[model samples]
Target: MSGDVTLLLQAWRSGDAGARDRLAALVLPELRLLAGRQFRGERAGHTLQPTALVNEAWLRLSGLERIDWQDRAHFVHVAARLMRGILVDHARRRDAAKRDGGQRITLTGLDVPAPEDGLDVMALDAALARLEQLDPDKARVVELRYFGGLGIDETAEALGCSPATVKRHWQAARAWLYDALSPG
Candidate 1:
């Protein structure tokens, strides 16, 4: 399975359309399963269903045919990024269609936490962008840790850093992001 996935990735990166489809077929089930873990706290009757989230993520991933698709960790990181984009885009669309314009996530049993200071998806994305500019590694630590569901060890391995460094960077990045996203 690993060899096949590697071949699919190589072929897809080499501009083979069939390889892209094969790559999607080979990787999407695991991707969906991983994505499911991130939303287990979602409320029962929430309109933002897990399937929609997974499908959106897959669609975005399937479109990344131009990159040099590397091994497992790289795949996971790109998937994480695409998934975050899907959620942010969905939030933006929901806000556009709603009577009250803002961003929020509805967790299980009905606790909807609004973004700090009416910060919508765009604001969050912009904050992430700024974070990326100031410290790309820290921003990526946040993405891999939170969105990719990677542990510190795994993130450190993916990032070619030590576990202790990953942990420190993760903590610092989260604090920075929270402050950056928070309303003054």
Candidate 2:
């Protein structure tokens, strides 16, 4: 299945529209799962649902002209990043309309305790941007593990690194993000 996804991705990159459609069909379920995880702690009346998120990502992905997709992991990494952007944009718009009372999301699976009140989506995005400036590799680890909903082995594969390295980066990135997002 992985090989099939990779082949389809390659064909799509080479301008095969049918391959692109097939790839979307093959990957939409996983993308919805990933998007669903992202919305877990969101407000009950949130405007964007998992399927909407997946559709939005697919629309954005379809508009790309020159993405050298590597494989299933690579494609998913991009999709996750796109979904994060969409969430952040939505949160920002909501905040603008509500005076900073936008949707907040709980941080989990970081192996570290999250805040009681949950964290602001924009705040996390800002902290992640700062982390990227300081240590891009670690930031990528967080993006993969947190935003991408990727496990250690999958992250390692996407990053072309060992699981041990992924673990280290994940730990370090989570600690850094925790401190950055914590109120002083």
Candidate 3:
């Protein structure tokens, strides 16, 4: 199944419209699951649902003219990243609308505890951008594991690294994020 998906992705990259459609059909369920996991961490009154997120990500992905997709893992990683951007953009807009009462999103079930309330999505996004600047691999580990809801093995597959490497990066990224997010 993965091999077929990979082939479809490759064909899509090469501008095969049918391959693009087939790939979307093949991966939409998994993408929905990933997006659903992400929305579970959102605030109770959040506007965007999981399906909406998936749709937005799909729309954004469809607009990309060229992508050198490596395989299923790579496609999923990109989808997760797109979903994250959509959520962050939504958060930013919501925050801008309510400056004094910005929206908050819980970062839960990623082996890192959040404050009793929740974390500001924009702040976390900014911290991740900084982390990317410092260590792109570590940041990607965080993105796949935390935001993407990928397991260590899955993240390793996406990153083309050993699970041990994923574990190390995950631990370090979590610690760094905790410190960066902690208030004085």
Which candidate ranks first by lDDT, i.e. highest? 2
> In candidate 1, what are the lDDT values of residues 58-134, reduced to their tens digit?
77777664678777678879888987787787778777888466455422211223443333556666777898999
Q: Distance from true position, residue 49, model 1, in Å?
A: 2.0
State how far residue 91 of model 1 sits from its true place (Å): 0.9
lDDT of 3 by residue, 13-108 (tens): 888999989888988888888777776766677788888888888888888887788898887778878877987888878878878435577777
Local lDDT at 22 for model 3: 88
Model 2 CA deviation exceeding 4 Å by range: 111-117
Each prediction's total of clashing residue pairs, residues at least 3 apart in sequence or on different chains, is: 0, 0, 0
Residue 14 shift from truth in candidate 1, angstroms: 3.7
Candidate 1 off by > 4 Å: 1-4, 15-22, 43-45, 106-123
lDDT of each: 0.72, 0.84, 0.82
Error of 2 at 74 (Å): 1.6
Ranked by TM-score, the better of candidates 1 and 3 is 3
Error of 2 at 152 (Å): 0.3
> Comparing 1 and 3 by lDDT, which wins?
3
Q: Which of the two candidates, 2 or 3, achieves a greater TM-score against the reference?
A: 2
1-184 per-residue lDDT for model 2 (tens digits) = 7799999999998989899889888888888888888778665677778888888888998998899989988887888789889888988888998996676776777543445556787888898999999999999898888888999999999999999999999888988987887777
Cα deviation of 38, candidate 2, in Å:
1.9
